[model samples]
Target: MVLAAEESQNEEPGPAAPVTMFGPDFPFPYDDWLRHPAGLGTIPSRWHGTEVAVVGGGIAGMVAAYELLRLGLRPVLYEAEEIGGRMRSVPFAEHPDVLAEMGAMRFPLAATTLFHYIDTVGLRTRHFPNPLDPHTSSTVIDLEGERYRARTPDELPNVFAEVADAWDKTLQEGAALSTMTQAIAHRDVPTIKSIWNQLVPRLDDQSFYGFLAASPAFTSFRHREIFGQIGFGTGGWDTDFPNSVLEILRIVYTEADADQRLIVGGSNQLPRGIWSHEPADSAHWPAGTSLAGLHGGRPRGAVTELRRTPEGIAVTDADGTRRTYPCVVFTGQHRLLLSTVRCDQSLLPRPHWTALERTHYMSSSKLFVLTDRPFWLDTDPETGEQVMGMTLTDRLPRGVYVFDDGPDRPGLMCLSYTWNDDSQKIAALDPEERLEVLLSALEDIYPSVDIRSHVIAGPVVTTWENEPRFMGAFRANLPGHYRYQRRLFTHFMQRDLPAEQRGLFLAGDDISWTGGFAEGAVTTALNAVWGVVRHLGGACHPDNPGPGDRYDELAPLELPEG
Candidate 1:
């Protein structure tokens, strides 16, 4: 427990340029593309108001819709539930300002593309209270009937330091973390490709746990276990142990898990903001045009069926309304195609179907409760420490984060955030039952404190696996699934595919190389936007080429079929 490591504070700063989610795969500069003065591209006047069906109102769908609107096309969005999708923020009925973020609670500074939209929406962010984060007041690590507190990694015990050193050594010697990090920071394409292409084939079949076991630095079983329980930067990665090692490399290389910040209101604000935002520079539309105005008020209901017709792709909503469009961009969970939506077999190639079927997803669950005040900040006379700090434990609660919105406002607490087996274990419990179980665990950790007394509003719980519209929290590719990931990610480049598959496109974090991050959702959405523009005979500005424009030189490496 408490195995997380902080980045070496002594390491000299390198280049002034920051590391971004540019990609070890595609390496497209989405942030720069968005920032370009030339703008995304335009279509012919004849197709200016052409309707395009966009399934799923999540960040991916919202980005696609917003960019398409800028390109002078109309995007008809459909969602089963709320607009934010997995970036859900549940507010108490009485205190609307007091919110509990059930998903996507933290966002890293490296997600520049996502930040583009955040800044566009004029939202503010503060440093998130992750374990050992500098902004955090304190951190408590409870492991197997033992408890320890620390404000910094150096304050932790010797074994924790050893575990941290072992992890750093493992990444350096085994994964070339520094080389990739430098390559990414400087946007050194050739160097990135050279290192990544070599590693793809060599490590695609390796699991995260397998990679750790094989590492000379992580030879100790105890060290590996501790590292798995509490990973560096973020929380425990044991749930990701079965995923491909390459997944882990992508995050560390770009520092995607480091220096995270939470949006002032909530992460949901980004999607919701885009929904109502009117782009001042958009084409074809007059000033004050917004996605909200286009749809009248809200998006259409969920899509129940999809089929190719003589005219184009046909979409049937849950309300029995049907519409046909020349192209459709699907940003929902890929597995939805096989279950919730009655999709035509010809919509995708057989190999792509296989990829969809083989895709793996990780289950996630969270429980949040509102507190009367920031009681956790109160000092305990006995220990002279904050009553409760950000916590990481081996107990059922797993991890607990405290969010204080000034002493005058109600505080929100995520009592438990668990993934995979841990998530499934408590999936059957009701919200109150879940709260009780978590409170019991916390009581054992802080016997002197009375957490139940501070509770003001609900214990909202979400088991993403149980949500019909979203089968899982996010995709996590298993060992040897690199081929599947490549196929799905590259589907946007449809020239090689048959005519039928060309019109239907995929865009989501699940379809991205680095799944589970908002950056992936934004980048893949841009890819789909490019794909849509191309499908309608539009082209990006020569000065500002899109991802597909550079597909030849910067495409992800392909493994041998055999």
Candidate 2:
């Protein structure tokens, strides 16, 4: 599985510098990047020569590359793997099997950056309407036997009723801390050390378990056995194979704040389509940028290296054989920033590869088993929309999927798993044990169906966790990482490098605040590229990247076509 780009190392290594994200906020103000700039499209770039090189082929990188072209700036893209990073689409190799999504499954309209591209591409999609709702929704918080399904306004009568003090702490006076992310995450710590320091002291005296159960917030939760119900939604609540009652409830009672979002068709479409991942060749240019695709790539030994330059800011892939440019935008992972790019790390210094190493991210893997038969799921007949995914007695394999109408795989279905951390062991698990886990999970979710006896399958594996191509699923800040995030988000990536060296810009979901989600990846890439254009004093923006060109071709995906 080692890719060609990672196969041969023709050059010797000599380090250039260390980079970090410690201080100084550049690019877009953290608050504004979350939403589209009120006056976006007003400052369109009208240039042909302003070009950029972007690293990583994920949504952020691709969107940056694509946006560069839209903004009238040229861009070249570099990727270590296939265009789709973690947000990918997977299909079974055989005919009878259903197409499955191993990465992200949903998208929200609130994700402004992604929404822009979806409109641009004219990709058809269904809306989740509201991420959180009282109807068709139920969440149960069970600490041992005391359990219940969240229903009606009475079930979970607003956490605000009991946690008013805690809620007040979130604002400014009570136990609120310097930052909200810091405040909630530190609920376990004495609310004192952090913002919730005062709350911690109060928490110490009361049994939160009883307090929550008896609170009006949990009056209507009806408990159901959880053991067999896990891992049903492709990635239920198990992040790293470990789950908590709270995490499960969060998924069930999911409330997409200014931070959360989703995709309708899928999440991979935006990231992969937006960036240009080929080698940059001047000969094929139209006074703009030219790029070559990652024809092939794979993991080699321990250290994953690309037969490519640090993701260029001026061109996509810096083809050693092609002409060189001074700028590069990196959109891969934290580790890649240090290992792949040859730059000054002192800009955001913490430790020798320590910041990358000490960082803890949430990750998971899934197996999508497409069946030759329609593995039953509740559906709306008139609209054909998927309803309850698994029956009360339904035994789904590992993940979840709604069926497609056509007979081609009409019986087709998809299942996945996520929020896990044991990917390394997967390369070592015994085959039978893996099967047992898959079967048991399904049996529990759908016991009456005897799904194992009814279905025939196996194409189950997602590299979201193992492959070195990506450092890990988009970097999710650990409980404490939020403290340094002020620097992590606002500083480093936007630096004071000389024009020739402004090649470094971040393009992933690591430090984004509201910009930290999938939508965050969308705008973050735009911000970095636009920042580079302005920093270089080059004419780059929507108006000047090149003449306005619309993409007339697509996968033929439109509601009218469907």
TM-scores, all models, native as reference: 0.97, 0.60
How well does model 2 score by local distance difference test? 0.41
Candidate 1 lDDT by residue in tens digits, 338-381: 99899999999998999999999899999988899999999999
Q: What tens-digit string does per-residue lDDT give for candidate 2 at 1-562?
A: 1111121122423343111110111212222332333222322334454555666777777766665554445565556666766677665566422445566555543344466666654566653212123322332222223323333325534441333333223223321223322212222212212222223223323332332343443343331113223322222222322322222222221122322233444556655444333322222234433232222232111212222335432231334434244455566766665655444543334532354554555555656555555545434465353323422222323334444444444443444343443444443454345556666765444345555553465645664545566546656433333333334443323444443334456556664533225655665576575566554554323433311111111001111111
Off by over 4 Å in 1: 1-14
Supply the TM-score for candidate 1: 0.97
Report the Cα lDDT for candidate 1: 0.90
C-alpha RMSD of candidate 1: 3.9
Best by lDDT: 1
Residue-pair clashes per candidate, as listed? Answer: 0, 78
